[model samples]
Target: MIANKSLSRLMAHVTPGRLLSLGFVLVALTGAQAQETAAPPPLAGGSQDEIKQFCTNIADAARDQRYLLQKQDLDKLQTEVNDRITVLEKRKTEYEDWLKKRNDFMKQAEAGLVDIYKTMKADSAAPQLQETNPILAAAIIMKLPAKQSGLIMAEMDPKKAGVIAAIMASAADPLTSKDPS
Candidate 1:
């Protein structure tokens, strides 16, 4: 109240225009100070940019993690597939090697029988054939000419001769045997 009375006394001495201008200037300064101190209004939406940015960051992290997980799964699957293929390939190679050895053994056995039949006389070979494996003896007799094989078969025991004759007959065909009729 005292300050207002002092301002009124000072204004009374001043011209009307100057006093009005001073009052306007004071009002403008007070408004400027109020604006400077006042806080800005809050947004209508949730929290604002900070929360949105945090959500975006979280989403990005989730996406990156998902991609990494997929890559890890794919890598594991690929390794398993490669391992299976390698195992199958190795097994195939071993099987092929076994087949080659079996074929080599069969060829050598056949060649040995052929040599034995060719070197020995029918009487000697027939006695030996009767002593050895029936299947092996039949195979040797089959390598000889029909006449020679007949002589050897005649010398063998009847049951053994029948077995050899049966094997020889089964082995013969139009493609492999000469006309005996």
Candidate 2:
């Protein structure tokens, strides 16, 4: 019978050496699968820096890959090159959107700065009023637009502007701020 012949053939190949080799191979394959399922190492760079570096590297790799194309391979390379360009374009658009948002926030901040400058200008222009607080003067100097601050420094007496400038400068520098005694 076919079954009796098949059993005889299977028994003929079941040597002790072959069985051990098969078992070793099975264990090795399982070990390899376990390694494959293990988590990848964490990235060394932080988020923003990592994104920037990844984009730069992708652009560079694409450039390098393009240069390796032959005249006969032009069509194949063209598709690849186009795909790279599309990716770069998307990254550029995302960066532009972020920049626009940042600019909008800055614009709002600058407008508020202008309002504060206007009030300070009016108060400082008055005849009899005197601002006694150095902190108030420092705040006023700090709020002035950078160009306006430069112009005011040029227009006013150097000694008075210098004092206010020193206070504002101190307030700006985190390292220079006063420590509690």
Candidate 3:
């Protein structure tokens, strides 16, 4: 009963302003303590300088590992490029072989055509040559014996024969032929 009376007397003496001030003080102390605990603890054994030295020691090793990985990537890219080049070379060789075969076939066909024209009479050959491409007609005439070519030209229309002759003359000596602009 005496303790209760003393607590009541103490409460009666404390004003609202004093109680508010006490509450603010308690809050401030609690905040300060929380801030102190929030900070990270220092390393258990190593000093700051030792930790820095350890990081420095590993720097070169880390850089070398990174370089090795980059080199591996470059090597893989180079291998791919080489493989593509090899494939392209193979394709080029195949194309060259096909071109050669085609050229050989064309030459044989031209030769056979010349032979057929050689056996034909000028009257029969002239009309056919006139109907043919001028370049091809000129080529055929150039390949024939001079006597047969003359006979064929004599039998052809004058305009057609002149054009064929001009083509033959230019083909025979391209350097000397004047461009008929």
Using TM-score as the measure, which candidate wins? 3
Give candidate 1's error at residue 29 in angstroms. Answer: 70
* Cα displacement (Å) at residue 70, model 1: 17
For candidate 2, the TM-score is 0.31
Tens-place lDDT per residue, model 2, 1-181, is: 9999998998799899988988999999999999988967666658669889889999998877777666439878888999999999999999989888987986686577557565555434321112335555556445666765565555555666677778788787889746532
Write the residue-wise lDDT of candidate 1 on 32-100 in tens digits. Answer: 999977967667566687789899999999999999999999999999999999999999999989988
**lDDT tens string, model 3, 1-181?**
9999999998999999999998999999999999999988877665877988989989989999999999999999999999999999999999989988987997898899999999999999999999999988998999999999999999999999999999988887858646432
User: Which stretches in model 2 have alpha-carbon errors above 4 Å?
Assistant: 1-72, 121-151, 155-181
TM-score of 1: 0.43
State, as a TM-score between 0 and 1, how close model 3 is to the true structure.
0.59
Best by lDDT: 3
Residue 30, model 3, lDDT: 99
Which segments of model 1 are wrong by more than 4 Å? 1-89, 173-181
Pairs with steric clashes in candidate 3: none
lDDT of every predicted structure (CA atoms): 0.84, 0.69, 0.93
Q: Rank the candidates by TM-score, best first.
A: 3, 1, 2
